[model samples]
Target: MSNIGICEYVIGVIHDKDIWYYVGRYDANGMKLKPNEQYSSFLVDAKRYNDEDILREELESLPKTLTYKILELQRCPKCTKEFTEHPALSREDNETEICPECGVKEAIQAYINS
Candidate 1:
């Protein structure tokens, strides 16, 4: 897996809360989760590692099938919130992408500071 690049999206199930979520654009190291983060079950599809939009679209349509119990998971790394709109790159780093809301907030802050 190290040979492959980092995965931008991953499917994880929190058994205790019965919640399923997808972490987006998280490159703490690789496709693997942080040490503190725990999930009853999780999936890392090497094929979908870099396919952010495609993976989300496929996961969205998965509920229609019988394979997935539920598909309510999406979190922005910066805000840790579910973002409906397209992601925005953080101005702070330019490389770190975040949710639209956070992006707006950052822009506003930058404008105010300037």
Candidate 2:
């Protein structure tokens, strides 16, 4: 049997310490959250994708602005902190991806050991 599903767009705002706050979602008519509906205390708790390609394609189609960079929020597996910066490869494994801060720390540790 096949499963049915619905897809929607979401918006988030960066908050303290790079934490992302889920602001709202878009419906068939348009984006659902209005000015008064905005909030910043909540974290995004839902997985919003099944197909990565489709997700990227849809997000890329949205209009860009001079004020903001369009990107996906990601969590660094090493520190469990959220980040929007490009990840650096873990020196310990050279395979695991980590946040930029952790990468710098790793480099420093390596230098100390040498």
Candidate 3:
């Protein structure tokens, strides 16, 4: 059998006159749609599409009151914590953010080992 790549789907809705979007991933089997309770219009019945471009087009076709933003987060490998803030200057990659707590812990451990 040929290997198939996982597809990402975006969910969006209009609430209190504002637009919000959430990104989710899925495979050939099925998708997991867990909408945030805080969002006013939780998109429980939103459809999942494989192509991001097509999803963007569909979202844009919605009413003018609706808007969408792609959600992306990079997590730290050590702490397994997701962060929206940019990584420190010492970090080589912009996508990954080593949380401050993890950074301090690693620094102290390195110093002790040295």
Top candidate by lDDT: 2
Error of 3 at 113 (Å): 13
Which residue pairs collide, candidate 3?
none
What is every candidate's alpha-carbon RMSD to the true fold?
Answer: 10.3, 7.9, 8.2
After superposing candidate 1, which stretches have Cα over 4 Å from the reference?
1-74
Model 2 alpha-carbon drift over 4 Å, by segment: 1-66
Alpha-carbon shift of residue 18 in model 1 (angstroms): 28
Q: Please tell me which predicted candidate would have the highest TM-score against the true structure.
A: 2
TM-score of 2: 0.47
Q: How close to the true structure is residue 20 of candidate 3, measured as C-alpha lDDT?
A: 46
* Model 3 TM-score, 2 decimals: 0.35
- For candidate 3, lDDT tens digit of each residue in 1-114? 121233446455545565544434332356543444323333333345667788777666545654555433335565665433344422334454476677777667768988
Please give each candidate's TM-score. 0.37, 0.47, 0.35
User: lDDT of each prediction vs. the true structure?
Assistant: 0.52, 0.55, 0.49
lDDT per residue for candidate 1 within 1-114, as digits (tens), equals: 232224344454444554444444334466655523423233342122346677667567543332323232235677666433457899988987677889899999999999
Using TM-score as the measure, name the better of candidate 2 and candidate 3.
2
